[model samples]
Target chain A: MKLSRAVVIVSTCCLLAAAARADEAPLEGQVLVLSAASTTDAVDALRAAFVKTHPQVTVDAGFAASSALAQQIAAGAPADVYLSANERWADFLDEKGLVARRRDLLSNRLVVVVADDSKLEVKRPADLEQQGIDHVALADPTSVPAGIYARQALAELGLWQDLEAKVVSAADVRQAMQLVVSGAAEAAIVYASDAATSDRVRVAVELDESLSEPIRYPVVLLNRGAERPAAVAFYDYLLSAEAADVFRRYGFLVMADDHPAADAVPVAAAQRWWGLSRDEWLALRLSFQVGLCAVVASLPVAIAAGYVLARWQSRAKWVLELVVNLPLVLPPVVTGLLLLFVFSPKGPIGGALAGTLGIEIVFTWLGAAIASAVVSFPLMVRAIRLAFQAVDPRLEMVARSLGAGRADAFFSVTLPLARSGVLAGCVLAFARSLGEFGATIMVAGNIVGETQTIPLAIFSAGNRPGFEAEVWRLASISIVLAALALVASEWLERRHATREST
Target chain B: MNRLSFRCAHRFAGGFALDAAFETDAQVTALFGPSGSGKTSILYMIAGLLRPREGAIALGKQIWLDTRRGIDTRPERRRVGFVLQDHLLFPHLSVERNLTYGLRRRRGENSAIEASRVIEVLELGDLLARYPRNLSGGEKQRVALGRSLLSGPQLLLMDEPLAALDAPLKDRVLSYLERVVEEWHVPTIYVSHNASEVRRLAERVIMLERGRVVHSGSADELLLEGYSPSGDWEA
Candidate 1:
């Protein structure tokens, strides 16, 4: 049933492929080409070619894991085309009748890769089951297209059962390959196209064609393209012989030169504040979760630090201050790198946690929250310390004279006096945590549903070839949330100021 | 006789040395001294809020401090109530809560002062809900006195508690203080530099100069104009 659809799409593309450049003047506006992650280089190459003939047209290409790209299209993200790595995701949008045009453009081969220094030998699919072979990283098979294809290939070879226990599922094909690079997994099975991009690993074995399912890249023009003529011209250009040659240069087999929303979404977009794609909504929701967890987790420690800094009289007080403020002064990326070293599987802290406690932090939502808490902790401590300082020590002395214990005096009198400042500190910390990116990415890898916070989503969406629209959507959500938190913090501080006068 | 006996050598920083030794059993013994003459310092030491370098302070049956024995009791456990010049009423609490704060502490432990009795004595029924921030200087001092008295302390130290009030307010609060002493019969050490205050309040006065007690006499004799700084009494 899918074979018929590809054939019809090719014949349709061939008819307009030549005529697409006949009048280049009409292709002056932007043409968005949305594709899977593996096709970034190839898509760039095609855009370069198309620009030589139609220099007036701008082709914005975005790339991501196929399923994520498909969900974006289904959520009515404004884009001109969809160039996907597998048939299922395209079929997903097709079922929703989102496809205005569809075609098969390319095919890819799968290979098993191992680190360059490893002694482990996997000459065939069956060789992956050796005794020393620990984890085999693969993109999540239940959902990710690459994992789905890898599963088919392994099941055909009868190798899936033996390796199932050793599988450490990655979020995407690139991440699967990265697992081997970091020595977290002994081997990873990824597309030959992705394998060519990295030099740290060698393709130990390429699975035979008969054992693997036929890998196909499909391209679709969504209903949003009807608004832009340049988008349709670019869609036709993708199926041209010129685009096929560029695909081959990127190590993708040139089958058809295989490759791999806007108007309908305007009503939802009109809502402005409430309008959000599912992924954007999730990003907002996850940001709040991470922010709240981060603040809640660090509050006790922050309060203790605040009290000590405010009241403790010791020579080492300056040292404590410096240590609390260290994260604020250090570059966030440096902080992330330091966290990665401690939390990575081979690193001291992460190794013990994973082995002894069965707690996994790397590439998980918990790790993201911890990273956020660390960065926002200093601000909380500083504000709380100021609040503590504002309270008169004599009040506590009077409380003590009234037969109140130190702890009782603190809770009843001191803490209540400083409540406004402490509340303002919490709001500021939450807002800062929501925007945290560098430290978060260092400790928690960007896994869309699990660890990808608002900043992470904005970063990846902006970098993706055609997902610029998604970037704006995520960015706007971040801005709105942060602004609200600031307003709340400001209101609390004003209350504190007014309290001081009375 | 009921008494407070204490001896402290206040060789504090900045070369300020106080060699003080006193034993008083009078109904009211005023710590009469100018500023920086260690009057409030003695009151704080008795209250257990401040520690002296070397001292043994015992109020009748209880030993409040014995630095030689390493028995410096915590202020909260010492059963000593202090009302400083500023009143020092907890600004965050209402008059009722402040009054009951110490009363709550002594609960179920054979407490002497009752919260309702304190409320009636201080006339704080209308001011129960009002915070210290909203109270006048005299009202605050009354509340502070009420709070301390309600704690059922063995020793009550007033370090010029009415000094911040105006003339009329000071007289009014002073009468209340006199009534408290007459009614509760708590051992009171009222610190005052004013001659009129010493005459009006203290039955006995101990004059202090340069951290030394120079005179021990009735308030009337101490207030005589011919009372000299060159002491006739040994300090």
Candidate 2:
């Protein structure tokens, strides 16, 4: 009977050990985390820390304005976890039945900031009303959560009515802080964390928490991520003691009751192809694809415009010239915004196109291509026009007299002669498209793989504190691409010159 | 034989004016004039390259242009071959491609002026693979003439075709022109400021002076009135 009891105890011990083994199975698969722009540094640090312990898991992150991230999630972006700077967007997702679980993750304080060398002293919200503070920058008060908090603080202090006239609205908190850093604004109202990012700007006043609603960041795991074990592990790790410490270091007030921190393990440097990570390679490849599509799509229209501008003699020619060249001189962002208006779902052309053909352009690669095409059009046309202008008009006339139609003459005679210029223009346009950022971000929304090009990737990398290496890498790639394009065009022009002089 | 009639009045932006009129059924008619006398302008209007402010141009029963009637046939539909003063050979095309360009565009089944025949008559066989940029001035003019001939035009307009060549090259190209005209008796209007070029090429001559038709007669009668071998008319 003692032997029987011993066997039974052994079986029990074996069962317990098997269960423990099952619990310790390594988490694998990818976790996509979409976070607020203000949380970029904290999130990057947390991701680095998390990946160290869960070495088999990959955590891909995207950071933008919370509203944009929420919209992306609503539009069916494959985001596993979303960390918004405010509860409103999280609640919006919950109402849409998109959120499976959520909790308040962190909080922040709003502050007034001024340039490091500024003579104006802004100790209180009322100080912003001084004549010395001619301009004050803030994130868009109507939409961005940081700006809304700043607006509430100003209203609570009874300074909103007087200081509203001097306010310059920026797209995001970092941009608002950048204005003060650049001395473009006498002061700016931004998050304390963002203000801490730049040594060029100094925090003048931290608005009392009582002045505005408590600024809470809510983290949510979407329904799409509920079944993914790696996503759940990453989401749970975000609330652990290690992540809380990261948040605290980045000036955020950690609100989660953190669990025990994971073991600190060193992560191996990710494998690189030609000194670029997988994501950076994806961005580089997308840039070339988009640049090529832009050039190919715009070539026929550009050629026609160039031909008309070169040969047509009319009093109204200047009008056509101005319209063709407007994009070259306009702020690329303004050009992007204009394209957004015409290509948005509610727009006339966009609505009709979607209704009839089911073609959605906004936030897609095609939208990116269109933006690049528009931004690079003037350069293409100018080069092509110069090329066409250099061709003798008599050759076309001779073709015409030889029973060739206008189009036939152009294709056979004029276009062939201007081929080098057209090639140069194409290269120039492609290079310009590769560097197109302002319009691409506005229209394409910086979605990874779908629209994030090299320039956009660089912009994102530049915003995050720990990604300086990534920023330099992407910037160097851009320079290399542009240099190669310039070399190709120079070679073409030289060949054309030699052919002509021969 | 089809009769060709032309009348036009045009004013240049620089205030120069052209008012000329003539009708001919000859195989070769020359618009003889000095520089700025609007010889090339008349050829351009006839070929539909330029529109006169007031004009009517016709070849036999075909009304190519009548401004008052609001009818102006496009240059391609007019079926008139034009060889410019610069021998405007398509610089990007080889000699063979240039010669066949117009031949390929001919809408009619009129294969009377075959590409091989034109190539042989113009002696363009050796230069077929060479681009216009690689050809000499005289070679370019011959290729231009061959290209125009292969189009099977109802009429050919020669705008001082040898004007760009030096004297020796001009004589060689003029000989090629005579061979082309002899092989295919296409009705032609040749424009030249040089009296000798006109005398060599024209059966009938229409003299232009200060934008008006000063005289119209046989080439011998008009050119011999006051012409010199140096191509100047005695003032």
Winning model by lDDT: 2
Q: Which candidate leads in DockQ? A: 2
TM-score per model (chain B): 0.91, 0.96
Weakest 10 consecutive residues of candidate 1 chain A by summed lDDT: A261-270
Considering summed lDDT, which 10 consecutive residues are worst modelled in model 1 chain B?
Answer: B226-235
For candidate 1, write residues A220-270 as lDDT tens digits: 988878567888889988888877766766667767422440011101111
Structural similarity to truth (TM-score) of each candidate: 0.64, 0.78
For TM-score, the strongest prediction is 2
Model 1 pairs in collision: A61-A465, A61-A466, A62-A464, A62-A465, A62-A466, A63-A465, A105-A258, A105-A259, A106-A258, A224-A261
- What is each candidate's fraction of native interface contacts (fnat)? 0.73, 0.86
Model 2: docking quality category: medium
